[model samples]
Every structure is written in structure tokens, then in C-alpha cells.
Target: MRRIFLVYALVLVLLSPAFSFAAGWRDGTYEGWSDAGPRSIQYAKVFIQDGEIAGVILREYTDRLVEKDWTCYDYPPFGEAARTLGTKFVEAQLAEIDAYTGATGSSTGWMQAVERALKKAGDAKKEKQYFDGTFLGRSEVADRGYYEVVWVTVENDKITGLQVQRVLADLSVLDPDTYEGFPLEMARQAYAQELIGRDNADVDAISGATGLMNMLNIAVRDALDRASTK
Candidate 1:
């Protein structure tokens, strides 16, 4: 009986999902708890990239922040009712933006925990930033002296947009309406979609568009280099 119990217990432990947590969570949720504020306990989750907090989600809050517990004659703005809510933080794209007006203490507590988590993450990755703006890059045309031009836009340290144009000696752009060769439109679409929301240095060569890919890379590299130097 004792041997059977031991074997069963071992089987149950081996099958549990907690064992999988060790290997599968590179991009995963991390929970942070604040020293409870007057209204409720606060919890936060931050998403990291390579090692920096790229995004944040406020996961839990107490009852006072959620409910307006009092009702009066023609009155709806007292107690927790008039407080600045946690929703403001979630709607904000960047955590550094601002603190809720009436909820200064809560916001400070929430940011304190998040800042601690960020410090922990910083140890995992080197910090990086990009110059935000639009840049034009050109690759010399073939021996015929025509060149390809590409525009790459960087904002908030990410590649947000790109455009490509092939120019002739007269500097007139080829009409996209009449051009059907080489899938330029498709290549352009692919480049823009794939490069957006990623670091400029992290772009990879797109398949089936090798030549244009190289040209685009040259233009983008020059553009990004110019941004960094400024």
C-alpha cells in the first residue's frame, strides 16, 4: 500500500503543468505587487523585449477603486467616485506618460513596482533608442545613372513606415499604374509590414525580393545612421 501511494504521488507530480513553466516562458507574463494603497491592493504586469519593459498592464485593484459606494441627492462625485482611475494607465501607450490626477498616491505606488521590474529587466538587455523622423536613402542606379530611392520613418525607437521609388535620369518616378513587372508593389508592402514595430538594425532579407531588398537595406541603413548621428 505504501509503495502504491508513493508511485501515484510521483505520477501526479510529473504530470502537473507547473513543471512546464521553467522552459516555455521567454515572452511571458510577470506579476508585480505594490505595497497596498488605501483603497485596494494593486498588481501590475509588464511585457519586456530583449530585456526592457515594452508594455504594461494593470492586472488587479481593490473594491474602493472599482465601486462608488455612496449615493446622495443630485451627487455622484465624492469619496472614491471622484478618484482618478487605473484605466488611465492602461490606455496610455507608454508608461512614462503621466499620473492620474486624483490618484497620485496609487499611481506612484504602481510606478514604483513597475520601475523595480524594469530595473530587473534592464539587467537582461542593453538600452537602445532611435531618432524619430523621416529619412530618404538612395542607391545609385545601374551603370545607366538611374538610382532607387527609399524612405524610412522611425518613431519611438521603432520602424513605423517605409516607401520605395525607382527614379530615371529625368527624375520622374515610374508610374505604378502602368508597371506590372517585378512585383514592386508586393515587395514594398512586404517590407513595410515586416519592418514596422521592429528595431531598424533587426531587419532581415525578405525572400523573393533579394535585389530590391539589398537596395532597400542600403537606403534604410543610411537613413538610420543619419538619425543616430544627430
Candidate 2:
């Protein structure tokens, strides 16, 4: 009987990591990352202070669909999760909150991303600034026939400028009207104006051209992620 009890205890010890999590987290900053694809996966960075979550930041999310032989987005019910979801998570801390509006795939994915960040916060708490330099980011539009390229300048750990380069391919003619006006640069140029002096905190979608902004956000995120790697 004693041997059986000992063997059961050993099994629990071996499986502990699956249940291991920070019941009491220290204050600082923690990042939670998710898989690729803005629709399903979300990357989040959270700041904890005085044992309460102080701030939360999210990368742009994409919603894509194939309609009438074109790639388009099916905007989720709640377009922004940082303010709503983040606020709820911070309020609940370790307790689960009602799905931010609903448990649709996007909302569920957002919740999972937040949980991962919180779980990681216990061990690798960090509050590092962006690596200073200029970097390039690129993301393909899947079937949109163009790529969004952004050159971001970082100085003193903050964004100073953004130069956008729209690369149009032969397939760009799929939407013919102007020679290269399909993926307009004007929206990005305006967005560049908005990015000045902002950290990733302010990288929200441009009001009128949010579609382009969503695509650009992925590329911009890639650039920022690369800077972190180096």
C-alpha cells in the first residue's frame, strides 16, 4: 500500500509542469506570444505593477475571407480587444473573466494569448526598450497581389519615422484601373505621419484605411520582432 502511494506521488511530480503557473506574480513586464496569422493568433505584452496589471498592448489582427474570387475580411463583432479584453483581464488578474463579449474563435484566441503571457510573467519578467535602429518589415497579402513593406526608424527606443514602399506584382493587374494604384501608398503615407514619436503602443489602424493598416501591422510587427531577436 505504501508503494502504491509513493508511485502515485511520483506520477504527480512528473506531471506538475502542465499545472505549474504563477499563482503569485512579481511586478514588471511580461510578453505573451502566439502563432502566426493575425486572425487566429495574437501577440500581447502586459505590464504588471504593484501586483495588478497596469497596461496591455496588442498587435494588429487580420480577418480574411475568399469572396467572389477575392480576398476580403470578415470583421469580427468587436474590432478592438486591447481596451476591452485587456481591461477585463487586468481586473480579474488570475480569475477567468467572461469572454470579452463572446467566445467566438477570435475572442477565445485573444483570451488564450493573454493567459500565455501571464503564465510566462512569473519566470522571465522583462521591461526592455526597443532596440534602436532602422528596420524593414514585409508581409504578403496572401491573394491581394501586393506586399506591404515598411521601413521604420527607431531612435532612443521610439519611432521617429516610417517610409512605406508598396511592391506591386504582375498579378496586381487583377484589379485594373490605374497602373499601380491598387494598393495605394497615400494611406500608408498618412499612417507614417501618425506613427511619429509613438511606440508600439499607438500602432492602431488608420481610420479610413484600416485594411491596409492591418496588413502593415503584420509587417511592422515582424520588423519589431526581428529587432528583439538581435
Q: Candidate 1: which pairs clash? A: 141-146, 141-147
Write down the lDDT of every candidate, Cα atoms only: 0.54, 0.57
- Candidate RMSDs in order: 18.0, 12.7
Off by over 4 Å in 2: 1-22, 37-40, 63-76, 80-82, 124-230
Candidate 1 lDDT tens digits, 80-163: 322333344334423444655655555665665454344333324424454455555566466655566666677777878777
Q: What's model 1's lDDT at 30?
A: 53
Candidate 1 matches the true fold with a TM-score of: 0.41
Clashing pairs in 2: none
